[model samples]
Target: MIQHSLDALARFSAPDDDQLKALHNSIISLSTEGCGPRECRALLNVFERFPDHDGDGLFSSIVHLLEPCTGYETMLIKSVGPASVPFNALMSDRLLNSGVTEVGGQSLMALLAAAKAHH
Candidate 1:
């Protein structure tokens, strides 16, 4: 879960160091403690810059905190409810597995699509 969170965090641009790390911890805490989606959303929302994300800034973030990857199965995208696990979380794992770049053409939409599929 830590690795997943770290991978998700990588998609974000902290410019300054440690900001993403702090966000990662907050998200994990929210998810593991079973905090409401509002809490989870707040934590994730803080790190993302939103529509300003070079297009439709997509997925990423923490769910299992700093411990091992035990609770990933229980995590989900905040607004989408627990049913839709963050595509970023899945993408982070895909990225580690070299699944991202192998996705598609040079188009941004294609890339996002691939990330979604692979994840």
Candidate 2:
């Protein structure tokens, strides 16, 4: 299921408005279908790496969809890995200030603290 979505995304070199909308719909569908932690991580990686052809609004939308997924905080931090400092900074800022759900926010904070301790 995840691979199908990823493949659909990969096929678009330069998606038009309709294509983008379709992608958005697909993402919404994926959320409804339920994504596992590994699948969510893969999706996050792809979304984070997506070229900012639309000022990153698409990426942000995609991230929002996965925000409620299980193990999202752990997958989000793991998705950061050791690259893309700018993306990491953006995520950090979002995590710090965004109006995420209370449980989500607490989970992210706990993961961040654990990561900090390990590093």
Candidate 3:
């Protein structure tokens, strides 16, 4: 999991320094054992920012981080439930209105559709 997480972070080749710093800080703040449940729950809020990502690489990185986990089904569902709302909003705002460039190779609507399909 840690290896995957590191790989996920690496996908964001040149993230904004401040955003990267905040993400790093948040990751470090999570107690692997002491507050595992709470940290897991917090992932929902964190992933919600993915759709609003202005950086292609960073968007891919966030998608990789949110990839479906085998035994972590409960955590995954909980995380996606809250994240879906803002994520969908972002998609609608960008894809249905603004002419913002797609992230990496996928459009906002396509990404959201894929995410919903995964769920």
Most accurate candidate by TM-score: 2
Report the number of the highest-lDDT candidate. 2
Sliding window of 10 residues with minimal summed lDDT for model 1:
72-81
Tell me the whole-model lDDT of each prediction, alpha carbons only. Answer: 0.39, 0.59, 0.43
Number of the candidate with higher lDDT, 2 or 3: 2
State which candidate, 1 or 2, has the greater lDDT: 2
What are the root-mean-square deviations of the candidates from the true structure over C-alphas? 11.2, 5.8, 11.9
> Which of the two, 1 or 3, has more TM-score?
3
Q: In lDDT terms, how accurate is model 2? A: 0.59
Report the C-alpha lDDT of model 3 over 22-84, residue by residue, as the tens digit: 556444433232223333444444445444553434433333333332222244333333246
Candidate 2 minimal-lDDT segment of 10 residues: 80-89
> Candidate 1 residues 8-106, lDDT tens each?
444555533465455546465445655443444443443344423322222233323311343322222222222223443443454435433432223
**Candidate 3 global TM-score:** 0.36
**Model 3: how far is 64 from its true place, Å?**
8.7
Worst 10 residues of 3 by lDDT: 64-73
TM-score of each model, in listed order:
0.30, 0.57, 0.36
Ranking by TM-score: 2, 3, 1
